[model samples]
Target chain A: MNFNTDFTPLTVDPDKIYDYSFSIIEEEMGEHSFTDDQWKVVRRVIHASADFELGRSVMFTPDAIEAGIQSILAGRHVIADVQMIESGSGRKRFQKHGGDLHCYIADPDVAKEAKEQNTTRAIISMQKAVRENEGGIYAIGNAPTALLELIRLIKEGVAKPDLIIGMPVGFVSAAESKAELAKLEGIPFITNVGRKGGSTVTVAALNAISILADERAKK
Target chain B: MNFNTDFTPLTVDPDKIYDYSFSIIEEEMGEHSFTDDQWKVVRRVIHASADFELGRSVMFTPDAIEAGIQSILAGRHVIADVQMIESGSGRKRFQKHGGDLHCYIADPDVAKEAKEQNTTRAIISMQKAVRENEGGIYAIGNAPTALLELIRLIKEGVAKPDLIIGMPVGFVSAAESKAELAKLEGIPFITNVGRKGGSTVTVAALNAISILADERAKK
Candidate 1:
């Protein structure tokens, strides 16, 4: 059976694929205000989504990249709002640096607490996360409720994290949760404006930070 | 510390949030040619990505939705290309119907085999999956290589899946693999054009099919 090959893929090698992807992204994403370090994180987000619109919408605090890198180098853990982020992340990179990734959404205790409180597992997970992963990097990818809860925790002085990656996707409260995150002070965060974010894109952003951290360590 | 709440989220209730999201998607998606069943899947894809352009690009074989629903009802398992799809899926819905989710990308044997073959774990995983899960649903979300391998297996008459959800996102072979899937005949499949798909969106599509299956079973 002969197959009609309309578009031939450039290459199948993983490393070369990444290099080619970055080059295309760089060419398409003409001029940007992000620093060299910040562009790496944004480029990966664009690569993951293939949506330059969302990539350009990404916002980062001045110290967010350096804060995330330092958190990784210091062996701090990551508190993921959902298991998808944990599953999609480069865990070995974190593990090699004596850091780990944690997601409390599936924990029985969190489930029970959420049920008892008449709230979401996302909120309960963040509460449990603060007590466990001090100085951790909080990554909220899918749930807007989780990002809102984290913002509340930061405001209440109940949680202190080195960095917060708040890019939750949905129609109900996603954009609002991110807007709240932008209003937060004293906590470095990487987020975007609008309702276009997900576990895959959040994983891409976190992986970018981890890659930068790893590169820094090697140097 | 007082927080500036400019935009308040509609609701924190999970069920209400889904209802709200679907309403927004229905209102924003405008006119579409998809049937009711197909629209359900496509609507969920739009909800997951928040990108109408990508959602509009989704294509389905005439029998794709019915095939996916029948497969779920028949207790056929799912072979995921990445762990994120498995993690993000509503596994409870599938499990309640006696179906299960499987991802072989992390298996030691697949990794070792990929090293020996000088290929990706995705390719090796598909090779192993075709042997194990006959009449299963093949869900490829992250790896273009896995989708291409599955297409090869199908062309060779080695793999016979009930439904194929081939939407791998990347700059390398993503668009090409999907283009290849579109060219296949006599196979029920759900896929989108271009490099705009991911584990979250794939999970959304699968969950929509499973929901329809469950609804049918209830009736």
Candidate 2:
């Protein structure tokens, strides 16, 4: 059924926080496209997946999104617009950096457009972002379906991201999505503790990546 | 920041889904509230936190919500309600079961009354659902902040609920909210598997609980 019908702002219950989990998972699986030992200094992140199935609410903390973007910038990964399902408080955080921040949404007006065309639009956008910014970080948030399609495009030589970061912040699809990325033979994925991560952990993953990169750079 | 400014539907790039992680985490630190630990079951679930955040054009799935309620009916604890926040879909699901559901935007009219009353009407309604349905499962898909508060009220004798579930499906406040519920000493929590979970995993957790209960019954 159409999940999007009546919408409203959400009321938060702070005391209920204990019910969630804060688990992160990181893996170094074989690359999907890159060689086993190619060793590419990666910097680009994308947050392209389906929006939450529920109503709209401010889920991510600005600090978390900022941390993710900051890591890419510090690593000299030109920050591509965080490819999200839509824009909200999180987008504002990225826009503050004064860079090209593109918001990719499934335009209802273009619902008739072929899925391939929509994918191509997104791929072209990513390709442009990477081409314009050398050594830039292309980051995508935790949208597994979108990421997978993008990966297919990349493997097909339509788009190329230096590094792919998988940071989907929920319990249902996070693991499977990450696994999909892990299956990509060459790219290194930096992910969260999993399940109860939310925005804080998403940002934390970026922080971890930045720290790891710093350590590597020092050597 | 007023997070509820642009209330629109979010979209999904089917191709970009791979960019997200989909794994589950199983932590063994917490205490189980049920006497029949053998009856308990768990699974990880995930979903988009907001419809507008991703853009508009995605469909909703009631499988997660239905699964949670069914599990509780079958006797199991649910960790998350991945789609509770989608007012329209949530309400429709509730109605299908002969339940009454309502959605409020918290505009000036409702917000003023809500503030003056020192309570949210929605929480009250949800609490009523829990209290009225003894030995039955009731789930809330929004953030736990308000639900937790309602639970505290119930604990204080101001409200009552036989069972209450929290499953806000996003990376933003999901973990923090669930963590709050987990902290409650007596309440049993069945959460998602890290960032990978969504509505699918939340239902799985409930199924796990039911299976455990079934196993114990046989013994």
Candidate 3:
């Protein structure tokens, strides 16, 4: 059963992994109230993270999931705030239709300008991302400051995001930033309301949304 | 401030980032006792994560940091249990010689085999990693089962790693696995003592060690 990925031996099947993950999530979340689409997002997040608590924390604008699906189907870009978010996103499959997964935090120029501006590289990275790709998915999984900056950019009419996935984990500003993101209008968003989110969960959301898009297209 | 990377613009200088990181760490850790080298790994983890609590949680064997530095200098391979660790590792600099970073969790074969075995891809990935590299750095950041499997392989005489960097996050087995890793005689390691480790911190430690090796070579 060794699956091969780029010539390496894999011990898990992608579909089977997700299938079993949903099983676990369902078993653990007995007697809970969640819509089918909400389960689609939360179950995958649990699969990626094994953090069941996340199921309770996840929030989405009424149209956020559908917005993400539409954007993905349209081949809009997906810009992650950090490399892990981009890398774990099942990036190749999601972007198989010409969409791109981009992260500028590791870019040398971002680090340099961040220092000069005395601001977080994440803030600068968001600006670069907005400039490069408008009306794209903004996946912020590692930096609350990046999410804040994205919101700020939008407020300034400098950035347009079709859907925002904000789940940066930590203590300071992690929860606060998500709260701010949750309140943003005119921009659809999925957020975990507290400090319990991370890159893995963010990527899970991306993967689930991509899968949803594929499923919807087949129908 | 021109940090060179692919495509995305970066702004923070590497040196300045680390300097500011150390200052934040110092301010957060008002009265702690750590040697200079331990601070190197801890401060960088905090920099990468913005989690000051990590500075207190990071643990290192007396020689683990040095062991990792020497392994890189000698051009040994780095095998991360997860993609995030591999991606965050500043892998190119450490492998400026002929060393490489290997991760098989995303391997299709591993995924398939893991489903068949009712085990994690991480476990199978560890076995494959051991077969491919000896006396390399074993970097396990996202899965305790992988670290446990590595130890089992070592006990079974299947492999020998120069150093172990285990920082798997979660509630179950995260701290327990690190405790076991610390007990392995003659196998140097860097680990957090509790459930406070993650991929970012693990990679931060890896990057810090690489920087130390580069600094040492400069002299």
Candidate 4:
């Protein structure tokens, strides 16, 4: 699958914002370093974020791309670290595939647990997400604490995820968490190198994968 | 009201993420240009978003900071262009000051109107927001079209707002809309120079002003 063939803009804008963004990003990226599927995500990320830094920051384990797509194709769960990520994800794409998009940070129970535990609500949200869907695709966009908790749970043999898209933004643990994610052996993850990530970047990757799955299925 | 006076670390952690981020940004932003209150907003914007692009991009009319603080102090409404901005904004701060935050992008009524009018839902959301709260603080984070529409309404005297925080993040009209904002002579606003703004940046500004108001009131 070539980069251009794998995905198309879903909107009806005559200006083709996504289309022109793709072309410009490809020009700046210069070389074809990523696989076609992986490029699909990277292109959409720079397109969505308008930051060419992602071209250098985006790190993907070999199987991470395929894992996200397969999960999307199968209509698996996408559990986000925060409501912002869940809100920014590709809505119509998920609707078409019957995707289960969830973010528990706003749940009354999660808030209660966080207050009782003296921990961040994001940590409680991750614990609840892993408890509900062990093999689901996880997207962490807002909280480094959540990503760190997810890593700890996976190490303790507590839960497993099909894929992890870790793009938490903040100076506190944001860069360190991505470095930790890069070191993990078999989690199959997509992450960046530094503190330059947010829910928008996380959702861009998700929206890209969902778009890929949507177009691929049509064929 | 120096840069270092108005804000201290909010959390207990000794490793101050916001503090260090502020120092680095000050170094990057060489000369002190903004007013003390204005610098508070700019510092927090760079803190929340680790992009120095905002230093050059952030645009504020002379009285925008004091205007936003005054509106927040008075418990005016805050209408956002997207849910992500609405969700990421510090909620308790608003409640403490009796501020009302709203986003109608996903509302069924907005959806119905968008379908009926053949326009984007964000335009309809802005229309509804100005109709409901004539002196509200308008926060636009994810859509240039929404910002453009808001500017149009204000230009046409169809709507009025206390302040406009326009930071839509994309390539299309992001820069143009901000340029438009700078042209509005009397409309108090906080905007940026380019496409390097989003829900995070928009909420960061809102959060900064709210925090300033909250702390200033405590004194």
Specify the highest-lDDT model's number: 1
Instruction: List the global CA lDDT of all models.
Output: 0.89, 0.36, 0.78, 0.79
Ranked by lDDT, the better of candidates 1 and 4 is: 1
How well does model 4 score by local distance difference test? 0.79
What's the best-to-worst order under TM-score? 1, 4, 3, 2
What are the per-residue Cα lDDT tens digits for candidate 2 across A29-136? 223332211111111111111122110111222233334444444534433223222221133433334433333333342233435465434334444444455433
DockQ, ranked from best to worst = 1, 4, 3, 2
DockQ of all candidate complexes? 0.75, 0.07, 0.20, 0.38
Descending-lDDT candidate ranking: 1, 4, 3, 2
Per-candidate RMSD vs. true structure? 3.8, 15.8, 7.1, 5.4
Report the Cα lDDT for residue A68, model 1: 98
Model 1 TM-score relative to the real fold: 0.95
For model 1 chain B, where is the 10-residue window of minimal lDDT?
A: B1-10
Superposed Cα deviation of residue A96, candidate 3 (Å): 5.3
Residue lDDT tens for model 3, A124-188 = 89989998886989998877779988998999999989999998875446777899998898999
- What TM-score applies to chain A of candidate 3? 0.90
For the record, the alpha-carbon RMSD of candidate 3 to the native fold, in angstroms, is 7.1
Candidate number with the higher TM-score (2 or 3): 3
Q: Cα deviation in Å at residue A27, candidate 4? A: 4.2
Flag regions of model 2 displaced more than 4 Å.
Answer: A1-89, A95-106, A109-143, A160-163, A168-189, A192-219, B1-148, B160-163, B167-219
